[model samples]
Target chain A: MKVLVIGAAGMVGRKLTAALLAAGQVGGQPIESLMLADIVAPETPAASLPIDTIATDLSEPGSAASLLQARPDLIFHLAAIVSGEAEADFEKGYRINLDGTRHLFEAIRLSAQLYRPRVVFTSSIAVFGEPLPAVIGDSQDHTPLTSYGTQKAICELLLADYSRRGFLDGVGIRLPTIAVRPGKPNKAASGFFSGIIREPLAGMEAILPVDDSVRHWFASPRAAVGFLLHAAQMDTAPLGQRRNLTMPGLSVTVAEQIAALRRVAGPAATQLIRRQPDEVIAKIVAGWPQAFDAQRASALGFRAETSFDEIIRIHIEDELPPVQP
Target chain B: MKVLVIGAAGMVGRKLTAALLAAGQVGGQPIESLMLADIVAPETPAASLPIDTIATDLSEPGSAASLLQARPDLIFHLAAIVSGEAEADFEKGYRINLDGTRHLFEAIRLSAQLYRPRVVFTSSIAVFGEPLPAVIGDSQDHTPLTSYGTQKAICELLLADYSRRGFLDGVGIRLPTIAVRPGKPNKAASGFFSGIIREPLAGMEAILPVDDSVRHWFASPRAAVGFLLHAAQMDTAPLGQRRNLTMPGLSVTVAEQIAALRRVAGPAATQLIRRQPDEVIAKIVAGWPQAFDAQRASALGFRAETSFDEIIRIHIEDELPPVQP
Candidate 1:
């Protein structure tokens, strides 16, 4: 199967690329070739198959069409401006997140009469907002609080419509907030969720923006990649007209996350988390979902780490160097 | 208040225009001027105030900007292609329903730094689709089965986000199917819902394409106009970031409709209804919401007819000549 990975330079994109390369096959079909695309050209990774990387801005009218020229059998669309950036710059957010995704879908629709590639899009839990039930069900309304979330929700609607029309085989997975994100902290309001875990594990002090009582949904990067792969190969017949699925995730409070870190790395790591509160981030996080009854995704064979301890362990095993005896 | 009514030529638009002129004021504000626009110029209404009609297509670049040049104090955005046409033509649907609406919102946002207008947008119950409960709640997930519903759902998201951003004071009302629609029957799949009542009242045969047991939500043209005016003038503080609402409507089965017709206009009017099930329309209607718990709209003072008999009577009062006893 020929595969195309958009936004292949970002952290999750890079990890997904690595996982795809390692798997060598999807749905039992051997990976014949690969194409990686992003605004900045993705780094060339070691692969036995023919691999190509290109820098392309999807917001540009013809860019999506150009990307579809090769007509890869499977397309993983992970490109998006982060939530913070999207909310900060409204036009840029809609231009890239909304228009860019539409361009991609349109390009696919007009690609050819018979070409129906499997398209897996990564949505976000930001699609749900406040006044939410403790355990949000799969059928919860999209009351996105931010422009970024609105863009995602709109795209999810488009994905479903396009899939129903048979223009492409599409599956949109609304990923939970990825915790223990491997890298330096970013400007995303939800960044602290990862920073508090990753920084401490790396023996550095991290600021706790919200109180211990603040709770949010989470999944590790490893689990996210697994979701993308499963979405690509899954039987879409059962999905029918509803192409999007809210991914399964662990629900944990900030206190639970800290407790898990303490259990995994002892008192030193837990002590590294400082109790400096940031109201802006806290208010933003307040609108987010604490948990979800993502029954649809779970029933479709997608799974995530069940506990904060497992999430912490995954972060350590994946990102940190092994401890010497 | 200077008012701009886009799509002022449609049935509901004409009714709203008439109502606006009769009131001569909105929210205790005296009439200043009126501007009506549509793809084809809306017919000039006999109003005492200064009223201008213009031909415009909102999807075209700069059209929305031109419309907002005067910066109307209140805007009624009631333009859209019907569901059947939108379902038939994908590109046209997105262009008019989605991009057109976005263009309008963007125009308002970019009009001036401090200028914000009350934008009353007419959404539709089509935003909700099947796998539905007997009575869908205000927080139902948007699972639009048709391209039309998808477009409406996307616009609702945009409306809320833009409103939250303070670009515009927007309110989206998800109108139930407008029953007893006047004039010749159009090609809309839901047209028969109105045709059965309208044709029978006019002493003509009307086809009932779905089974009598098939239920759906409905409101009258007058009620829809009321909802729009209320949405434009009501205190939006209670809405907060959740700016869109499913307007209240009576839910009734086709059997109830016929029964109401018999009660209102005798068995003669009911006998004009012919039962000829069209599987195509039946399948389409089956995917629609049968009822809704529109608590938010109800609490906000938007009301609709409580019974199908009342609905039929409304059609007779609004469209037919007065009967002398």
Candidate 2:
């Protein structure tokens, strides 16, 4: 089997490529060739998996057609500008996230001259916004808060329609916040959810923007990977009109995250946290959904970490501990 | 009130312009200038009102900026390709409906002038497709069955987000089938619904594709204009996160239409109907949602025809000979 990862250089993209190599196949099919593409040339996996990596923009005219020329059987679409950049620069967001996804789908349709492939697209929980009940149900209409969310919601609509029309099998996974992400805190509003734990674990102080009781949704990186693999292989017949699935997530609060941090790294780590009120960040965070009732994905056999503690443990496993002097 | 009517040459556009003129104002403000734009130059009553017509392609680069330059205080965006044309030529559909709408909203945001306008856009029931309950509730997700529906759903999302940000105040009205449409049937699959009755009334035999029991939604042309004008003037404060709304409609099938025709004009109109099954058209009709729960739209003060009988009466009043004739 041949596999192509469309966003091979990004965080989850790199991990997925590694997981594919570690498994030696996709969906029990023996891997023959792995083709990877990203906006920038994907890092040659530090002498790990034998892979061919190329750099290209998917939204460029005919670029998707050129990318799909090799006709890999499994395609993972994970490329997108983050929320802040999307809201700030609408043109870039629509061009990359919306037009790019459409181009990819059209490429598959244009390529039906030869073959069809299974496409697993990474959507986000951001497709949902407020006026959402305390617990958002599975079949709720997509009311996005940000431009990025709108783009993702639009892409999901295209994916379902394209798949239903038989261009290719498509599964869109609305991933949860990847907790304990192994990196310095980024600009995402949800960054602090990981920042408090990550910074404290590293003996660095971090600021909490909202109240400790403010709840939000999440999933471990391990589970996000599982969602992609499962969606790529599952029988899409049951999906019928709904091709997009909200991946299972843990609805935890800042208080819960800090408590878990203190348990793992002691009270000293907890003491590194400071309360600083930033209403701008708080208001942005307020628009973000706290919980998701992802019954559909769960019923379809998708899995995730049951608790934030497990998510922290997964982070520790993925990224080795700091070496002592 | 300065009014901008996009797609001013289209059927609904022409009627909406007339209704706006009849009212002489919107939201209780005196009418000032009217901006009319379309690919085809529109017919404006410049002799009576301050009307400017521009033949502009909305999807072209900077076209939206050019349109927004007029700085109309309120806008009615009622442009879209019919479903069959949209499905047949997918790229054109996305270009005009999806990208065009985005460009318009973006232009509104970039207006360095502090002039924000109330944009009223026309959506369609095509946004909801198969596996539908007998009555599709207002809260259902837009599981569009066609590319046209997807494009409309995307535009609706953009409208909501833009409204949320206050870049523009907008309302998306999901119109029902405009029964007794005063024109020839175009490529839309539902065009047949109007075609059968219109042809029969014209003493011509009309083809019916689906079962008489097939139920679908409807509103008269008069009601549609009401929706547009209401959307322009309604208090949008109550619609916190929901900017898109499904308009009120009457649910009737072919059998009921024929019955209504018989009652209105005796059996002469009903007997002109022909039963010819077209598999392709039947399949297309099957996937569309049959009815709607338009509570939100009703609460906001939009109303539709009461029944198929009343709809037939409307056609007679608007399309048939006057009482003297």
Candidate 3:
């Protein structure tokens, strides 16, 4: 099996690439070659297998086609502009998020003579909007409020159609908010879900924008990578016509997240959190979905951390250095 | 109010154009001018107001842009390839159904320096797929099973996003199967919904490809035109972020339709129906939605016939020449 990872320079994309290289195989087939693509050329990690890194924009005409010259058997489409950036720049958002994804799918169609690659696409929970029910179910419709979410939802629909038409084998997984996201805080309104946990663990103060009563769904970065790998190897027969799915995740309030953080890193780490209110962020977050009954994905063997504590532990084990005496 | 109809040659488009011309105003604004566009030039109907008919394909580059040059106050984007045709020709489907819609939207955005036209787009019930509940609701997710359905669903999402961003005042109405269609029968899988009634009423035998037990949702050609007109004038403030709506439609089985036909046109007219099952069409219609709880559209003043008898009467009153003794 050969593999291609789009957006390989991003955090999840890099982690997924490393994991794939370490495993050296997918669905019991040894990976013979790998292609890592992003807007910026990714750093080449030392791997026994053949690997190529390319800096390219999928939205540009023929760019996607060039990347698929090898026609890698397993393709992970993880590239996207985050929600904040997408909202701020509408043209760029649609260009990269919507047109770019379509370009890639069309490229796959052009490439597929007999070889149909397994395409694992990363969708987002933002595909849903409010006037939402207490808990969103698998059957809930997509009414995306943001440009980014709408783009993801459109891609999911396109993927299903392309898959049904036998152009490619597609699986779309709508990821939960990733708690304890590594690196610096970004512009995402939901960034606080990770900031409070990540900043505190790193001995830095983080602002809590909303009230403790505010609840949300979450999974860790490690679990997200796991989802990609599983989707790549899973039997698509069960998916039928509806190929997109909301992934299972831990549902917790701000207070509960704090409690879990206290348990994981002691009271000292918890105290680093500060209370502040921003109506703009709160209003935006209010429209977001808090929990979902992702029964379809769960029934298909996709799993994530059941509790925020496990999520924190995974982040510490994978991202943080060992504690010094 | 200046208006432009993108698919002015189609049945609903023609009806909608006639309704608009008759009223001479929309939302209390006097009709100023009208531009009618389609793949073929629509016959110039007798109207007091200024009207122009042009032969154009929206999928062709610059066609949508040319229509927008007038910057009409209201735009009816009703162009699309029907289901059977879309499934048969994949590229044509995407080009006309998806890309053409996007081009119109992008043109709207470009034209929105000061003028933002009210865009009333026609969507369809095919957006819902099987593994469906007994009754679908307005909040039901779009899980399109066919290429045409998928294209419509994607357009709905785009319309919402564009509306939210203030690029255009857009409303997408997902019309149910239009029953009692006038003129010749088309190749749509759901064509039987109309053919079974239209052909029989015209003294022609219509094929019944499925059993009478199969139930489906419907609205009349007049009602569909009404929905479009209402959407054009309604205060979009109530719609908020969700601009697309499932129009209220009558839910009835084939047996009920036949009974209604008997009541309206007598046994002689009903007897014109022939039973000849085509496995292909039956399979396609089987996956379609049976009924919907379109509470939103109803509350918003969009109305449809309650009984199939009323529907049959509507066909007689609207389409047929007076009963000749």
Candidate 4:
């Protein structure tokens, strides 16, 4: 199977590409070739299979269509301006998040005569806003407070519409916040969710921007990549009319995160976390969903870590070296 | 207040226009001028104030901007291809329903410097699809099964986003199926909902396409106009981030409708209805929402007929002349 990964340079995209390469196949088809694209050229991985990398803005009129010249059997669209940036730059956010997704979908639709590729789109939990249910179910309405969330919700609608019209076979997965995100601190309001764990594990101080009582949903980076693969191969007929599903995630409060950190890295490491609440971040995080039923995803065989401790272990094994005695 | 009605020639648009003229005000501001637009020039109604009529497609590149030349303070966007036509013509549906709405919104956003208009958008209950709850609430997620519904859902998202960004003050009202419709039966699968009552009341036979047990939500043309007028004047602060709302409507089964018809128009009038099963239409109607909680719209003072009999009476009072014995 020939696969194309848009936003291939990003964290999840890179992880997904690596997983795809390691598996050597997608949906039981041997990988013949792989194409990676982003706003910046993605690094071509060392693999026996043919791999091509391109730097292009999919929102550009013909940029997305040009990528379809090869007509890969599977496409993973993970491209998006993160919440903070999208909320700050309205035009850029809509341009990249909303218009870019549409451009790619439109390109696939226009090329449907040749092939109908299985397209997996990455949506976000941000699609849910304030006035959330105590436990949000897959059936809850999307009332995004931020522009980025709005963009994601709109794209989910488009994905369903395009798929229903038979322009493409599409599946949209709303990913939970990836705990212990292996990177420098970012500007996302929820950045602290990962920052506190990642920094403390690295023997560095991390700021706790909100009260430990603030709870939210999460999954490991590995689970996210798994969702992409499963979505690519799943029998979407069972999904019926609703093409979007909220992926299974571990729901935990920040205090539980600290307790998990203490169990994993000792009290010394946990002490590296400092509480200095930032009201702006606190206000933003307050509106986020704390938990979801995610019954549909679980029933579909999609699984995630049941506890924050397992999440921490996964992060340590995946990103950290053995701790010194 | 100056007002612009984009679909001024349609049923709801004409009634709303007439209401505005009769009241001579919206939100307590006297009407200075009114602009009406449609694919065909809307007949300029005689009024004490200026009424400009123009035939134009809002989807055209500059067409929407041209309508904004006058920069009316209150804008009513009700232009759309009916459900049946939209379902039949895929490209036309997206072009008109999706692109047309975006053009108008973009036009408003671009012209934000001139003034922030109160935009009253006419959405529909079609935004809800199957797998619905027994009573869909304001928070029900949009999972439209039809292209027309998908377009409306997407537009609702855009409206909320635009309103959040302070580009325009928008209020989207999802109207119920209007009953006792004052027109010939069209191709909408739901057309028979009105046709059965309208045709029979006019002393003509009407076909019942589905079982009498088939239930759905509804409001009268007069009540629909009432929703528009109320939505235009209402304070949106209570709505917070969710700008779109499912307007309160009566939920009734077809059997109840027949009973109500008998109460208002006599048992002889009810006998004018004949049964004819249409599997295609039955399947279509089967997917529609039978009821809604609509608590938010009700709390905000947007009212509808409490019973189906009142709805029939409304049609008689507004559209039909005095019934002769």
Q: Rank the candidates by DockQ, best first.
A: 1, 3, 4, 2
| Candidate 2 residue-wise lDDT, A1-325, digit = tens | 8888998898899999888888887778887878889999998774344578999899899889888877889999999988999999878998999889989998898886657789999999899887778887777789898889999998999898888777888999999888878788887777888888888877899988888988888998788888888987898888887899988899998999888877777899899999887888898888877887889888999999888888887887788565577
Model 2: DockQ score: 0.69
Predicted candidate 1 versus true structure: per-residue lDDT over B135-247, tens digit per residue: 99988899998899999999999999999999999999999999889899887888999999899899999998999999999998889999998987899999989999999
Model 2 ranges with Cα > 4 A deviation = A46-49, A59-66, A203-206, A258-277, A322-325, B44-47, B185-187, B195-205, B253-255, B267-280
TM-score of chain A of each: 0.98, 0.96, 0.98, 0.98
Provide the lowest-lDDT 10-residue window in model 3 chain B. B182-191
Model 4 / residue B24 / CA error / Å: 0.3
Question: What would the TM-score be for candidate 4 when compared with the true structure?
Answer: 0.98
* Selected candidate, larger lDDT, 1 vs 2: 1
Query: What is the C-alpha local distance difference test score of candidate 2?
Result: 0.86
Instruction: List candidate 3 segments past 4 Å from native.
Output: none
Q: What share of the true interface contacts does candidate 1 keep?
A: 0.97
lDDT per residue for candidate 3 within B120-218, as digits (tens), equals 999998899998999998899989999999999999999999999988999999999888888888776778888888888888999999999999999
- Tens-digit per-residue lDDT, B54-157, candidate 2: 99888999999998877889999998887877888878998999888888998999896587799999999889877778898888888888888988998999
Per-residue lDDT of model 4, residues B102-165, tens digit only: 9999998897575789999999998999989878988889999988999999999999999998
TM-score, chain B, model 3, is 0.97
Model 1, residue A55: distance off in Å is 0.7
Q: Could you give candidate 3's per-residue lDDT for residues A167-217 as a string of tens digits?
A: 999999999998778999987788888999999999999999999999999
lDDT of 4 by residue, A34-72 (tens): 999999999999998999999999889999999999998
